[model samples]
Structure formats: C-alpha cells, structure tokens
Target: MLSITNEGGSDMKRSFLPLFAAGLSLAVLLSGCGASSGNASQATASAAAYQEMPAATETAVDYSAGFYDAAAPAAENYDMDYGSDAAAGETAAPSGEGAAQQAADTQRKIIRHANMTLETKAFDEALREIESLVTGSGGYIESQSIDGQSLSYRGDYYERSASIMARIPAEKLDEVASQVGTLCNVVSRSESMDDISDTYFDAQARLETLNIQEERLLAILEKAESLEDVITLESALSDVRYEIESITASLRRMDSQVTYSYLNMDLREVLEYQKISDQPPAFSTRLSNAFAEGIDSIVVSLENTLLICASAGPVLVVWLVILGLLVCAILLIVRRVQRRAEQRRAARNASVQNARADQPPAVNIPPKEPEDKVK
Candidate 1:
C-alpha cells in the first residue's frame, strides 16, 4: 500500500509540475502579446491624432541645427537666409529696371516750334517774296489772309496786311525767317528750339515696324488656307493698319515742322515826299531874299573858316613842334662835324712843321770848307 501511495503521489507531483510550467509559459506569452497590442494601439491613436490636427497647428521647424557647436567638427558655414535675400533682391531689381525702361521710353519722343513777322510796301509783293522763299525751301503756306482795300487817313493811300503760315526744313527755319524779314521791315521776330527728336524717331520706328508687320499680314492673308485663318489675318492686319495710320499722322506732323517755316507779315506804306508847282517870285520877295541870302553867305563863310582853323590848329602845332625838334637835331650834328674838321686841319699843319724840323741841314758847311782851302 505505501508503494502504491508513493507512486500516486509521484504521478500527481509530475502532473502538477508540468501544469504549473505550462501555466507560467502561457502567462508570459499572453503578457508579451498584450504589451505589444497596447503599443500598437497607442501608435495608431497617435497617428490618428496627428492626422486630426490642422496644417497650421504646428509651426515650421528648421531641422538642421548644430548642437554643441563648439564641440562639433569643423565645417563650412552656409547661410540658410541667403535664398530669401536673393529672392528679395530679385523682386527689387525689376522695380529699378522698370523705372529705367520707362525713362528710356519717355526719352524716345520728338518736339519742335517757330515764329516770324514782316512789313512791306505791298501785300502782294510781300506775299510773293514769302511764298517764293518758302517754296524754294520745300515748304507750303498753311494759312494766309490779305486785308481788304481801305482808304488811308491821308486820302491817297491804302492799308493792307498778310499772314502766311509756311512750312520749311527745320534746319532752314532760321534761314527762311531771315529771308522773309528781307521782304519787309522786321516788325517783330521770335525763334524757338524744341527737341522732339525722340518722338520723331519713335514714330518713324513704329511706322517702319508696322509697315513690315502689314506686309507679313498681307502675305499671310494671301496664303491663308481657310476662312478662319483669313479672318485671323484680317483682324491682325486691321490692328496693324490702325497703328500705322496713327504713327503716320505723327510722322506727318513732324515732317511739316521739319519742312515748313512759318512767316506772318504786315504790308503798308506812308507817303514821304511829293512834287510842287515851280514859279518865279515877285521883285520885293526877290530883293528881300537876295539881301537875306547875302548876309547868310557871309556868315557861313566866316563860320566855315573859323571851324577849319579850330579843327586844324592842334595838328599844325604838333607838326611845327616836330619840325623844330628835327631842325635842332640837324644843327647839333652839323656843329659837331665842323668842330671835327677844324681839329683835323690844326693837326695836319702841326704834323707838317714837325716833319720839316726833323730833317738835317744840307751843303752849307761844304761850301765854307772849300772856300777856306782855296784861301
């Protein structure tokens, strides 16, 4: 019986140990699975929460930042803000560029102006002269007016005036104005210089470009394959034509200023001299006139003589003074020459006497000796 009891207890012990081991293993496995499930749930909830937040909820983060910069390995510094500065510079550049472009466009315009006036004896003659000058200069009158005939206050005369607007070469505007002035007494004159070279060139360029565009459009219209293409070409051509017209009008105006010089004038006359009847005078008038004339002649002669003396006196005095100085100089020179001549004559006589004294006595001793020997 004891053996039986021991066997049963061993068996129970073995079974219990096995069950206990299995339970611990199962518990550990379940705990690990639960822990893993909880982590997964939390991760899922966090992801959902992140999704629920608005895009604006989080401020932008600059992820690239150096921690413990002093302890970090050396590296080249790159300024992250450079991109913003470059973008801002780019934005500012166009404003200055746009302003410069606007200034350039404004610089491309042209401008000009002129004026003149004259007075002459006849309106027709003045007009003719003005016309000829203007026409020769390649200009035409823009407008003109001639006053109707009206009796002058002095009965025999008439009053008239003319205004002519002529176009001439801009370079010759001054020349034309001066020429017009010769037709009459220049009553008034004014000249002005304005620079419209930019506008003139601008119009010319636009017109030329438009003309080219028109030619292209015409070619396109001719070669168009369909109604739609033709319509498109026609519309574009119309716009180009309008632009050309506008530019041409501007060019015409500039050309007018360049071609025509303006002249405004007034022509009139005032009688100065006229002839009168020629007749003989009476005896009393003649006698009185003769006496007055004789006295007038005598007075004029005396006055003329006095005037001549007054005008010539200073000149005469200057000449006499100059002549006196010259004579004095000549006399001084003559006196010097005479003194030199006298000195020369005295020296010549002294030299001749000295020469004769230097010579030895001749033959007298010989004659005396010969006489003594003979004795």
Candidate 2:
C-alpha cells in the first residue's frame, strides 16, 4: 500500500510540472504584448507632437511677413479708404506708395557715431567745458581718461591729454559735437551712420514668431501625458525661451544705441595752438617744420633731464662722495707701494757697500808681489 501511494504521488507531480510550464509561457506572452502596446502608444504620441511642430512653425513664419505693417491698414481697409476718398472727391496717395513710404520712414533705425580729435592750450578748461557740455545737452560721459601729473619734479604746465566717450541723444549729437569744436582747436572730425532698419525689423518679426511658438509649446506641454512627451516638450520649450530672451536682449541693446548716439573726443594740452590743414605742406615747409620739431624735442629732453637731476639731488651727492673716497684710497695704496720699493733698493745698495769695505786683500797682495820681485 505505501509503494502504491508513492507511485501515485510521483505521477501527480509529473502532471503538475507541465501545467506550471504552460501557465508561465502564457504570462510571458501577455506581458510582452502589454509592453509592445505601451511602446506603440509612446511612439504615436511622439509622432503627433513632432508632426505638429512644422505646421506651427509655418504658420508663425507666414504671419511674420506682415508683422511690421502696423504703420498701414490691412488690404481690406484700403478699399474702404478709397471709397471714402471717392465720395469726398478728395485725392489720396496711392495705397502701395503711401504705405511703403510711411512704413520705411517710421521703421528706419539709425546708429550714429562721431569722432573728434581736439587740441587745446588749456587742458583743464577744455575738459571742464566738455563735461559741462555733455551734461547740458541731456547726455552723459560714458568714459573718460585724463593723464596724471608727475609726483616728482612737478611742473606748472605739463603735456597732458584726455579721452572722453559721450552718449548724447540722437538729435543732439551734431549740436553737441559742433559746440565742442568751438571750445578747442578741432584737429580731425569724422562721422558715420549705420542703418539697421532691416536687421531690426527682421529680428522683431522673428521674435514675434518665436513668441507664438512658445505659446503653442506651452499649450502642448499642458496636455502631455507620457513622461517622454513631457521631457521632449520641456526641452523644446526651454530652447524657445532661451532664444526669446536672447532676441529680446539684442533688441533692447539696439534700441538704446539708436536712441543715444556715441561721440568720441580726444583732447590734448599744447603750448601753441596750430591750425590743421587737409592738404600736405610744401617740401621746404615740411623740412623747416621737422627741424623745429627736432629742436623742440632736444629742449624738452634737456629740461626733463634737469628736472630729474634736481629731484634726485641728495642721492647724487651721496654717490659723488663715495667715488671721491674710492679715488683717495687708490692714490694712498700706490704711494705706499712706491715707498716700499724705494726702501728695498736702498737696503740692497748698503749691503753691497759694506761688503766692499770688508774686502782689503787685493791691494795688499799687489804690494807683496812687487816686493818679492825686487828681492
């Protein structure tokens, strides 16, 4: 009976294994189908979003064409205006010509710049006048640079210079520049105008389009259901916002420059005021001028050298004293050396004389030989 029970139990286990295997396979197939459906839905959502963008962009671009036409009414209003003109029996400018003229005039953006080089006999007076002029003209000094005075060997008058960059109202630029020319000798003057009408209007139109795109993107983002869709919309929205900010900043900068023109002033201090001429001088005249310049340079250099020497008076004295002490020491050493040489020579001569005095045999031997010959 125990053996029969074991066989039945084994048979039951074998049957259960097949059933368990079939159930696992069915679960895998169902899970795979669910995953595939999810992926397909995600793809559909992404495709819908991406496909909608090109149309939106096209609509924005189309609207940008007439964005700056506020100066004139729409085409439908033109017929009404024409009928009113006909009933009133009054002549009106053609719609196309009038609108084009008005729009171009109102939309022109000009950036003006003027550069002037000025020389003045009085540096302080000129600089103060310029500052006062800039303020009185409803303008401000954007930048200024003035050379500093010398700390050592300070002089009553030195060669000084100044550079000023002024921002004046567009209408006041010419007036201010002319007034400044009257204050000092104008060495050079130049003016430039940049027309940024097309650039400005184009950017503005593009900005309007971007604004529309931003609104559309925001609307789409609100309805986004999937995480991938949300992420994609956020990234695109972020990009659009960045471009909008950049364009807005650029427009503001352009507006500021157009409203306020730039005037550059260079001022110099001089002893003599000289007139500037556009035509070159004669060869002989240039030679004389060069010679005078050379002489003036030499005089200036000598004056600077004198000033430097005067400023360092104490240091110069100390150096001279040191040099004199060195020369005296060298002379003393040479005198001592000569004295020692003379003393040595005198000692040698005395020793030779003493040896000669000690030698008496030569004379005695000569006398003895004579006596022996006589014997």
Candidate 3:
C-alpha cells in the first residue's frame, strides 16, 4: 500500500511541472507578438511622414530660387538665352527655297532611238546575222520570227523573212543600227524618241518620301521608351526599309531602260536558187556515187555484225550450256507476253496432233435404213 501511494504521488508531480512550463512559454510568445505589432505600426507612421514632406516643402520653398536652380541658373549667369528667328523668317522667306525644292523634284529625261532593216538571200542567215549584230552591240534580241514558203526538198521553200527586236544603249542606237544594216540590204528604217521627264520626277518625289519615312522610323526606334513601343517601332522600321529597297530597285530598273533604246529590224532574204541543171552529175558520176554508197553500207553492216558477235559470243556459249534448263522458263515468259508467238505456235501444233490421234474413224450409215425396214 505505501509503494502504490508513492508511485501515484510521483506521477502527479511530473504532470504539474510540465503544465507550469507550458504556461510560461505561452506568456513569452504573447509578449513578443505584441512588441512586433507595435514596431510595425511605428514604421508605417514613419513612411507616411516621409511621403507627406515633399509637397509641403515644395510649396513652402521660394519659387524663384527653385526655378533658377532647376532651369534658369546657367542662362542667368552667362546671359546665354540664345534665340533664333527661324519661325519668323519662314513666313517672310518665300524666296529660292521653293524653287530649289522644285528643282530637286525635277528629273532630266534621257531619250534614245534606234532603227534597222536588213535584206539577204536567206531569211535564216539574216536572222543569225541580226542576232550577232545585237550581241556585238552589247544588246540582246528580244524577239525573232521566220516566215514565207516551204521547200519540199530543202525543207525550206519559205520566202525567208524575219523581224528582230533588240535593245542597245541609247547613245549608240544609230551607230549600232547602221552597223547592223551592213549585214544585209536596208529596205526601210525609222526611229523616234519620247521624253519621260514627268514620270521620272514623280518617281523621285516618291523615293524621297520613302527615304524620309525611313529616317523618321530610325529616330522613333532610338527614342522608344517601352518594350511594346520598341516592338511596334521595329516592325514599322522593317516595313519602311522594305519599301525603300523596292523603290531603289525600281528606280535603277527605270533608269537602265530609259538609258537604252529598243530596235526593231525587218529583214528578208530572198530565196536564191543555184541552177540544179548546171550542177547535175553525169551518168558515170552518178553510177560511181551509187557504187560508193553501196560499198559504205556494206562496210557499216560488216562492222556492226562483227562488233555484235564479239560482244555476244561468250554470253551465247553460257546461254547454250544452260539452254535446256532455261527453255521452260523462257517458254513460260514468252507465252505470257505473246500467246500467238513462236512458243504458243508450237503448243498449238502439238494440240492439233493430239486431237487428230484421239479422233475415231467415221462409220457407214447403211444400218439406219435396214433397222427401219425391220421395224
């Protein structure tokens, strides 16, 4: 009984000590939380005070001193309020600026003219000569055609007429055309030039506008303040650059075309015939020529046959050694390709022989009348 009572007393003591320690820890935690809350309140108040000071200070400060310190001090000390009357003068100056602008807008027109005509005995020859002339003139033939009459024997009975379209440098148009005409007889020729000054000036103005837009876009890109703004400006700059490039390319092409002139040449070579009667071979000569051709044909045939036999001799021997085994295979494929061909022809002949062997002999009909009489 005494041991039991002592054990119970010890357990009670241990439980009471733990409850006391737990109460003390709770009290310490509450105190720290309260202190942290007070400090946070004080910091909030300090931040509010800092924010409130700026506007009050600016209002209380002397306006002139603020302004001078911020914006006007250097000008005041150095008397450096430098000014320009560009805006004022702009209204008064109606002088040469407009004329200069107009002058810049105007473009000089370059005009070129070319003409050519050629005559020859053969239209094909005339066409070839014209093509050569154009090439020699640092030009190209743009168009060409042949016409008139077909010859049965020579395969060209055509009247042999041609027209050549070509391009050459504008300054050298006349000289090139004259040189080209020397290739044949010139029947007729004409050349004309038209000035495109207005068209050129208009294109120049548009090009200038594109250039200005390009420069403006570059400036905008430099001054971009936001990511979105930068993206938008970059896209716009790309478009502007594309436009500038296209315009420049167009300008160059137009300049090149205007600097050169087009030439259209009408050429005809009459069908000149050599007298065949005068050029006829004698009978002995004809016979000799026929004999020569026959000899040539024989020689060619002999050479070809020799080459074929030489190439195929070994293959033929190897095929002969395997010929029996391959015969059925060859027959199968051959029959498949051409049913009425040689292999099928042999099979058909064999079938006819078999049918003839299987056929019975014909019998006499005298028994039919005798059977009728007995009935």
Candidate 4:
C-alpha cells in the first residue's frame, strides 16, 4: 500500500508540472499579441494625423482659389469702371468712344467751396430767402448762427447778422450760389474748386492691389503646415484686412464730400440812420445839431469813466489799503529812529554837562580890567 501511494503521488506531481508549463507559455503568447496590437494601433493613429494635415491644407487652398476666381471679375469690373484704357478699347462698341467720353465727363470728382457775404436792408426777409434757396436746391444747412442787437440811442437802431454753412448738391452749386447772390447785396464773393479725380483713381488702384494681396495671403494661410507658419500668415492677413477696411471707409468719405459742395453764407443787416433833408440845413439847425453832438460826446465820456471806475473800484481800494499800510509802517520806523537818535544826543549832551560841572571853575582876573581902565 505504501509503495502504491508513493507512485501515485509521483504521477500527480509530473502532471501538475506539465500543466504549469502550458499555462506559462499561453500567458507569454497573449502578452506578445497584446504588445503587437498596441504598436499597430499607435502607428495607424500617427499616420492618420499626418494624413489629415495634408487634407486640410488642400481644402483650404481649394477654397482660397475659388474665392480668388470669384473676385477676379469684380476687380475687372472696377478697372472697367475706372476707365482702364485696355478695358475701354476691348469693350468699345460702335459708340464706345462716346460712351467712354461720357463716363469720363461724369466721373470727374470735384470738391467745390464758396464763401459770400451779403448785406441786406431787411435781415429776416433775406435770411428766409437764403434758407429757401438752400432747401429748393436740395441742400441742407450744416451750421447756422444769428446775432442781433437793438440799441436805443436818439432812436431805436437794429443790427442783425447771420452766418450759415450749408452743403448743396455739386451739380447745382453754381445755380445755388447765383440765386443766393440775388438775395442781397453781395459784399464779398469767393468760389473755389478742387479736382480729385486722380487721387480717387489712385486710391481705387491701391485698394485693388491690397485686395489682391489679401487673397494671396489667405491662400497661403490655408496651405500653412506648421503652427508657426499659420500664426505668421494669420497676422499678415489681419493687417491686410484692416488696411482694406480703412481704405474703403476713407474712399466712401471722400465720395460723399465730393458729391456735396460747401457754401458759407454771411448775411448782415445794413442800418441807415435818419438823415436831414438833401438841401443844406439852416444855420440854427446846424448849431443845434453841433450842440447835441457835444452833449452826446460828454455823456458818453462820463458813462465810460463810470464804467472804468466801477470795474476797477475793488482793485483800487485794495491797492490804496496796501499803500497806506506801507506808508504807516515807514513813518513809524522813521519816527522811532528819530526819537532814538534824539535820546542818544540828549544823553551825550547831559553826560558832557555833568563832566563840565564836576570840573573846578577857573577864577576871573579882575586886576587886568582895572589896569586897562587906568590906561
């Protein structure tokens, strides 16, 4: 029985050893397969990421190309509108020259400015007429100012003035100015014109150039591969776009300004004082007028003097107080100095007298007087 048990135990141990070895081999194979699978997946992912970059670049390039193609005709149209000689010659029909001439005539961009000063007997009526003129000419007032003063001297005198800055249509600028001239007596008249056709065309050409540059930059941006390239191209594209917007705004402003003409109108009321008869006045009447004029001059002088005094009263009082205080201070100082000097002199004199009194007095020579009397 003992021998049988030992043999069975040995067989059991050998079977367990084989089973352990098989399990270990299977575990190793599974680990190897998993590592290989993970490596394959990683390689595929890296390849896909690289492939996406080219695909995105190609798409961006295609989009930019399409945009450029679309904008090409617009640029051509701009050139044609701006009167490119080549475009004009190519599209010239039977009346092409005439059409071009008309376009050239109509495309002249001019800025007109005018200034006029008018004097009128009636202020309100003239102002109304001028305003009506502006409105009738399809114009608007940019700014307006009215000043008036009524002085009651010997009689009531009215002085009124108005200034208006208006914008009128360029086509009707001359007509409007002429109409305004008829409203009142023109004191001064001025008109000026500036041609901006060359400048406008230059700006248009610059805009086209910038637009083309922008399109090119956009195309380059789409094809950019590295992060650094993308950032650089994007910055350039932003600058170009900003410039394009600025130029567009400037051109629009210029166009508006050129379309409207500026008019500066100045209106003044002329006041005529009551005059004596055209015949020579009587001597008595002349004398009375001279006397009245003298009285008026005296009254005006007195009023001006009163005004000056009123305006300067406080300042004068302040100055007077300051001067009084300074003079008092100087007087007090001088008095004190004089008193001190007098006291010092007195003290010196007293000291000398006391010294003299302290000294013995010399006896008078009475014998000499008697001798002279005997002689």
Candidate 5:
C-alpha cells in the first residue's frame, strides 16, 4: 500500500510539473504579443504627434496649381523653428566663430543665373570653344537653338547664331563666363542670385515627417485585423507615399537649381564688333554714318538694276523687238503718205501748165503790157 501511494504521488507531481511548464510558456508568449502591440501603438502615436497637420492647411491640395502654391503640406506641417531646433539629421551650427561660417556653408542655398549676349566674327570657333568649356567644367548644354543662315544657304557667309542654355557647377559659373567673354564681344551681361534656404529646409523637414508617418502606417497595416481597418490604413499609406514622391521631386528640382548654375547666352555671328558706348554719337560719327548709308543705297540700286536685267533676259528681249517693229511701221506709214502728197501736187502743176499753153497768144500780150508798167 505504501509503494502504491508513493507511485501515485510521483505520477501526480509529474503531471502538475508538465502543466505548470505549459502555462508558463503560454503566459510568456501572451506577454510578448501584448508588449509588441503596446510598442507599436506608442510609436504610431508618437509619429502622429510629431507630424500634426496645420488647421489652416486642412483644405484639399490643388495639384494643378503648381509647386509654388501654399499647398505644400510638408513645408507647412513642420512646427519647429529652423534657427533654434536643428532638424533631426542635420548638425546644429557650431557654438562660436564657426557658427557663421557653418551657417553660410550648409544653410545657404543660392541659385545663380547669368544672361549674356555675345557677338563673334568667327562663330564656329566661338561655339566650339563654349561647348568645350561647358564639357570641361563638368556641365551640360540644357538647350541650344541655332537660327541663321549657313554658308551654303546664304552663298556669301555663315551667319549662324545660337541661343544656348547651359548648366555648370556654381563655382565655375564666373570662370566660364569670363572665358566666354574673352572669346567674343559681350554686348550685354547680367548676373543674379536667389536664396532658397527656407524653402529647401521646409521641404526636407516635411519629407522626414512624412517618412515617419509612412512607416507607422505600414506597421499598422500589417497588424490590421478588420477589412475596413485594412482599407483605411492602405488609403492613408498611399497618400503618404504620394506626398513623399511629390516632395522628393520638388527637392530634387531645387537641388538641381542650387547645385548647377544657369548660363543663358545668345551667340551672334557678325562681321564686326558692335560699339558699346554710353555716350551719344559724335557729329563725325553721324556724318560718316550718313555718307555710308548714301553710298550703300547707290550701290544697292545698281546691284538691283543689274539683277533685274539678268533675271528678265527673255522678257527684255521680247520688249525690245516689239519697240523696233513699232518704230519701223510708223516710219513706213509716214513715207507712204508723203509720196502720195508729192504725186498729187505734181499732177496739179502739170494740168496748170497745159491750160497756160492752150491760152498762149493772150498770155504773151498781157506779159508785154505788165512788163512796160513794171519798168
């Protein structure tokens, strides 16, 4: 009986131990799941708190309005002052003398633009040099349009001109401009700078905030239990992703503007460099100009007359032949009329003489009496 009781007690003890072990394991798993859920909830809450949308900007964005509009949610949603609360990934400006330098270095986002109108006697050489300069300076020609006559087209000269838009490293902008200036006569030149630091940082901060929101939304989506909850989370996730893409594109565009400087140049092919002077023309200049114009007009007239004669060869010959035939016909008609008049006068004279001869005796007596009276 003692042995049986001991066996029963040992069996019960073994069963109790197995059940306790199983319960402990289940409890640990349940606790882990609870902790994970709690941590996810806390993270989602934190992200939400960090990226609170402004009440003023709650209106729907009009994407067609373009990027310059007030619809930039990323720029508006970020709350911290840029000067005081340095953004998460960015290091704050150093405490002392280096502060100004550091601020200028990393905080400044300047876009430089230059415009120039140049005239060159040698267009091909100048164009080749400019292209070389752009390529050598690690730049690219954004756009180039040439609108003028080629040598073959014009027959006299290659008067081709080009409008070029090039992008190069900002530091090399001045150097390139200077080099180009040396290659041609600069009729006009202008330079400008734009500071977009505020805009840039705002977009960057907004992007960060949006990324946080996206990750949180993705996490919530994974654990979404109901179909409605899943749909809602997915919709939110898509919006977040879209916002991310838009902001990213804007930032990239800004980055390109900031990193590369814009060089707008108009290259004209010319035979002479235009005089660029602030002073009005002198009397001598005016007189010379007038004389030159007069000479040019005369020369142009002569050239035009020659060209007309050459071009109208067949027509001119036809007109000349018609004029000669007209003159000959007129002369021939005049000659025939004169001959008929002469013949009529002669016939009258001959008839008068015959009549005088028929009356000859009376004529002699009258002539003797008239002669005596005349003496």
Candidate 6:
C-alpha cells in the first residue's frame, strides 16, 4: 500500500511541476510585453509634446533665407520710392522713375467717406430724386430713417426729415456727390479720406507667411513616426489655419471699404412760414397785426400743449398709479397701528377699573369709635 501511494504522489508532483513552470513563463512574457508597451507610450507622449510647440522658431530657421530673398525686393522698392518722393517734395520725377513712382502712388489704397446735409422745399420730390440718383450711379443705400412732425395748421402735411447712408463705387464717389448736390440746397458738406495702403499690404504679407508655414508643417506631419508628433502637428496646423482665415477675412473687408465709398446724407424740409421781424412797424401796420399775432400765439400755445400731453401722458399715468398705491399702503399701515394702540389702551383701562372695584371700602367711623373707647 505504501509503495502504491508513493507512486501516485510522484505522478501528481510531476504534473504540478509542469503546470507551475508554464504559468511562470507566461507571466514573464506578459511582463516583458507590458514594459515594452509602456516605453513606447512614453516615447510617443514625449514626441507629441515636443511637436505641439509653436513652429515659429524652426520655421524661421528653415525658410528664412529663401523667404527673405523672395520678399525683400518689393519692400526695397517701396522704401526707395517713398524715400525719393519724400526728398523730392512732391515734385515730378526727372525721368521714367518719376512716372513709375507716381503710378505707384496713385495705386495706393484709400477709404473715402462723405457727410452732407441738405434742405429742400419739395421734400418728397427731393427724396425720390436722391434715391434714383444713388441707384443710377451703381450705389446702394445701407440704411435710411425718416421722421415727421405734424404741422399745427397745415392740414395733413407733415414737416419731414430723413437720414440716409449709401455705399457708392469709389470711382463714382465725386460724381455721385455732385449729382446729390443738385437735388437740394446743400446746407453743409464735408469729406474725408483715409490711406491704409501700408496696413493692407502688411496683413497680406503676414497671410502669405502663415500659408508657407502651414505647408511646411503639413509635410513634417506626414513624415512623423509617432502619434504624439501627429497630434502636435495637427494642433499647430489648426492654429495656422485659423490665423490664415482671420487674415483673409480682414483683407476682404479692407478691400471692400477701399473699393466702395461711404456717403452719409441728412435731409430736412424747409419751413414754410417766415419769422416775424423784431423791428417795430408803422402804427397802422402794428394795429392791423396785433389781433392776428394774438390769435397765432394762442394757436401755437395749444399745439405745444397737445404735443407735451401726447409725449408724457403714459408716463404721468404710470407715476400717478404708483403714487396712489403707495399712499393707500401707508394709510392702511397707519390705521392698523392706531387700532392696535386703541385696543391696548382699552385693555389697560379695564384692568385698572377691575382692580379698583375689587378693592374693599374702608370703615373709618367704626375704627375711630373703637379707638376712642379704648382710650
């Protein structure tokens, strides 16, 4: 029996040993794989962080030489022309150089704006004429507003006022202004010009620079071997793309402003009535005008009163309602307080009367008689 048992134990041991060995080997292999994966992940993360940084420095180093060479000529020419013009004091250039410089100067970007105020007796006619002129000249009205006030005795004809802002082509700005002047008496006219050539060109140059950087970054992204590098490059590319879009939008706006001229026009109807002179007239004239002036004054006063009431009626009603509510609330509180005080006073008086009535009356005569008898 002991021998048989020993043999069975040996068999079991042999099987267990093999199983343990296999498990150990599997664990070791797994550990090795985990270590390698961890190392790879770390490397990827480091690479990603490095790539995510701005490429300005690297881009400058890599492309500065070629970009500068390509972009310097225009700048140099512009500077030379500007310097020559400044020194020449607006005088004509001596040769072809002057003509070229003049041409360049004329090509500069400018944003023009004009403000005009006009008054006319025929308000509606003038308004229609102005609109027609603007449309005919390839211009569109950006915004317009009209206001009118009722004339006191003028029977349905309101004194009208209008303000209009229009955008006309830069080439036709002067022509449009002259045509508008003919529509009415030009009460006041003013114009201004802004030169933004330098700013516009600067923005364009910056846009080009960013575009070049974007292309280089894309190429680098393609060659990147690590996930980290790709993420970093993608972030940088997005930022570059955003800047490119913003610059493009700004350039478009500048171009629009430069191509189109802005005009602000204010139109007012001339008053039909003439003012009476302060100087005294002859006696006959004064006597005749007295009754007419008095009636006119009374009518004017009534019109002014009506205007004030129309403007302030709602506001005054709201204030009066609020004041009445406040007054009612205050009166209610006072009444409540007075009622409480009266109740307290009545209770105190009743308490005092009860105490007096509950007290015994003194018998003074009986006590004196007893005292006398005792003495």
Give residue 276's error in model 4 in angstroms: 23
Clashing pairs in 4: none
RMSD, every candidate, angstroms = 35.5, 18.2, 29.5, 24.0, 19.8, 22.9
Higher TM-score: candidate 5 or 6? Answer: 5
Off by over 4 Å in 6: 1-106, 150-158, 272-375
**What's the TM for model 6?**
0.48
TM-score against native, each model:
0.37, 0.60, 0.41, 0.48, 0.57, 0.48
Among these predictions, the greatest lDDT belongs to 5
| Per-residue alpha-carbon lDDT of candidate 1 for residues 173-269, written as tens digits (9 for 90 to 100) | 7787777766667655666666664454434333333444455345435544445556656766677678667756665555444434444444443
lDDT of 6 by residue, 40-153 (tens): 222223223323332422422222234323422222111212322332233221112343335335556688999998888888888899999889987889999989874334
Candidate 2, run of 10 with poorest lDDT: 71-80
- Off-target runs (Cα >4 Å) in candidate 1 are 1-113, 122-124, 150-158, 208-226, 268-375
Better of 3 and 5 by lDDT: 5
Runs in model 2 deviating more than 4 A are 1-105, 148-157, 276-325, 352-375
The local distance difference test score of each candidate is: 0.50, 0.63, 0.52, 0.61, 0.64, 0.62
- Model 3's number of clashes is 9
Predicted model with the maximum TM-score: 2
The TM-score that candidate 4 achieves is 0.48
lDDT of 2 by residue, 1-375 (tens): 011133355454334333322332333233323332211222223224434433443422222232223311212111213332243243322223344345445556789999999998878888889999999987899999988553223455567788899999888888999999999999889999999765654444444444544555565455444565567667766776887788677766776787789999989877788776879899999999999999999999999898889979989899999999999999999999999999999999999999999997665444346776788
